[model samples]
Target: MTDSLARMARRWWLALWLAALPALATAWMPVGDPAWPDPQLALVYVERTLKRSDDGLILSAHLALFRSSVYRLTVIDPGADAETPRPTLPESFQQAGSVAGVNGGFFHPDGQPLGLVIAQGRRINRFETTRLLSGVLYSDARGIHLQRRAHFQDQPGIDALVQSGPYLVEHGRAVRGLSTGDPSQRTFVATDWHGHWILGATRTRLTLADLAAALSTPGALTPWPVERAINLDGGSSSGFFFDRGPDVEPVVMRPWKPVRNLIGLTPR
Candidate 1:
């Protein structure tokens, strides 16, 4: 082939490869184990750059894995149900002395909970029946879990809980008809249904449909496929903080606005 023609062909192939990269997927791989120096610790942090199944947009994710047997997960809120503002996730994580933390459920413009919020065993807000309030993440005798609002039977003696979201994933698949147009940074919780759950978020902005699609995709959560997931209050309220130590750089996304509550982990 003529030199110029061969060069043109090579350029065309390069363009095609570049176009395909957006659709290329990456697996959730752990950066380091014990996420801390403790050899006995069970928290495993994982991350990946993956395409949104709904679209080819790329996003990076950070997830902290927790097994109820090894870690204590809690949902916390400032005491008052009125006119409350909160520190950013990183600061709050340090203050709470948790292994990691992410912003919690939705709230009204008046700064009141939109659904149920039981923090530290105190009922901060009563449960409400609403389409958006579809998932409840709480700690009961069985331990921390995610339950569909329709199925959650509130009895007695709960430790912490945060009711949130439109139920992103169910039965190991993304739910149909998640809103797709608006994109923003997201914080979410997902479970494997056997007491293994994840606290995760992406600084990369993504629509709910995109986030749900990514979560349900294989290798997104690593080791455990998502059985169910719930979206925490996102947009400017979305944030996450995982401090490995002063030596290791923490994974964090600071919220631009004051978050209503936090879901965090501590040693079991």
Candidate 2:
């Protein structure tokens, strides 16, 4: 072939590949041990291994990472009335068009959210604070923000909010004075420097302090730097779920009991 013709063909091939990149990145893939379903948003689903402080191992803990800019974060509140019926995570997931979710906040025995529960721009439950429940997770025009309850008050334009936590990580460091013993299944929500959100849970048991340490250490479990982290309701309430679409069955770690609220991720 002539030099000019060869150059033209190469240019055309490059242009075609560039145009196909978006579809290729977002296409569904096999749900193996670690899966990258969405490349453009940098979403991932994987099981990770971590060592406990007492020289034990946490094998196959479920972890997921989703960029805030790519996914909308919202909370699902069953209702404010204690007598109202509550739905399971799978039910809530399908209702909200959520791809993944985890249990949110603590609750009363009668099934009402114990602390503040805000959904769809309205406060459904009143705010309460104790030694363990001190932080609030809320979404507004600026995105999700986590702060101490003492410094936060109900404000306008909040899309969703759930109050829970001992503030696992603060100011890029693991918060001191967390429980070092009495390990149990745990779940947490954390934010990276880029404002991306991470929802993760331990299949194996780990105390509050050990969980924070793993998150703070670079490359310990998460690929991003967790600027702030907060513990959700763990123990019997700890669970994680991800809907991988029609082709692949959903991934779910069932909670021991029905939960009052959940935090979910919806595609933007």
Candidate 3:
């Protein structure tokens, strides 16, 4: 009888440990209704307008904690069908949802000269919010860190925000850099510049004060000067990508995994 009790206790403990494994192994993502194309990926839907005066497209991406460690890239396709189908990463990059060091993550298209230079190598994940903020600050080759500005009142009910580095305007103005803000609500903004400003958090969202500061300052850094930009889903649902040109095919950087929401940037 004593031996049987001990075995039962051991089994109970083992079951408890197994139940807690998921919570301990990964981060948390509280997305609404993520439009996941695959059971192992995550996705979000975003739609924004771009004014005719706006310049190039703005793409972004993020990872889903609970469903996957995969990243989903969002961009404006002027030629794609209205029904956008989710595509997987190249065979060389696709993983089994738990493997690491997969190829074909967030990257630029092949043979495309850098018109808008994107500096990679920085470590930005879903759990670490500051890393992404810091990535934007030192995105240039010079590696200049930015300051976090105070909150802006452009959007009300914002709880917190984070300012990137500084902006390099076309007129040589040192305007505030990019910012990620939160209005304590799920709000999505579509800009005329093909930029999408989404307000929601699967992990940590930015505030209004933070965005105002970055937008106000210009010429704050070196290399790939910030002309104009906007915020995205910072948590597990924030990501972007582009196909380089009209004729060029969609080179999957961060694949369109499952997401809670997305800020789709369509060309004007």
Candidate 4:
């Protein structure tokens, strides 16, 4: 083959490989654990293999680690009116100027956010109690905080908040009594020991107990030890989105249905 023709073929192959790299990297499979000595805006994608008593499952999760000191966490609402079009995860991410995010609390059929929702220091909804909805995630100038609704205090200087439930982890341990056998897609928000935020979701179906175990188990898919975690809306409503940067297209696991609210992480 001529030198120029060979060079052109090489360039074409390189272009194809470059285009396919992100899709391949984001595919569901286990990945090596990453270490972050200093907190910053970073995302690690993992397809974790879980050890269940009945059978194993692959849990696709994106672990986004970011310092609360360097980023702002906020809740986004698409409004309560029925006429307003609900935004998908990617739309909410772009609209909120978020680097990473996940679907927020559960909502009613007409798209009204259930439980409490406070955005940018403004109260959007009041606290409500339900069987499964038990946790609240809020942020203040001090940083992000998670607690059960019964324990959460209405504090000053609060910036954003969302209430969702079935607390997955508390005080660094997995909360007990989660459904261990029923498998379904799941989404969760958590904080590591150092208070760095983590948003994750299973790409495939898995029981809630399995997910809690995976997040709380050290040396698991979760890169850091999870100090606290809570289950968000899952099943058809589960969604996750992360913006790698300007050069790469964002990783978006879209919801099967439109969502009413989202929790977004914006770089500070």
Q: Which is the leading candidate under lDDT?
A: 2
Compared with the true structure, what per-residue lDDT tens digits does model 3 show for residues 17-136?
999875344322212432333322233322221111122211122222111122312221111232555444322122222111111112113312111111122122221223333212
**Which lDDT tens digits does candidate 4 get at residues 1-268?**
9999999999999999999885444333344444433445444444455443333355656556666777778888777677766666787789778878888889889777888789766787678888777888888877778888888889778888988889888888878999988788888988874857777777878777777777776656565678888999989988888887788988888889877778888766
Task: Give stretches of model 1 more than 4 Å off.
Answer: 1-41, 52-55, 79-88
**Better structure of 2 and 3 per lDDT:** 2
Model 4 regions more than 4 Å off? 1-54, 86-88
Off by over 4 Å in 2: 1-42, 52-54, 80-86
RMSD of 2: 13.4
lDDT of 4: 0.76
Candidate 2 colliding pairs = none
Model 4 TM-score is 0.80
lDDT of candidates 1 onward, in order: 0.77, 0.78, 0.27, 0.76
Candidate 1 global CA lDDT score: 0.77
TM-score winner between 1 and 2, please give it: 2
Using all chains and alpha carbons, the TM-scores for the candidates as numbered come to: 0.79, 0.80, 0.22, 0.80
Q: RMSD of each candidate? A: 7.8, 13.4, 20.3, 14.9
Residue-wise C-alpha lDDT for candidate 2, range 80-179, written one tens digit per residue: 4646576777888879888898888898887777777887666776878677778998887777788888989777888889889889998889899999
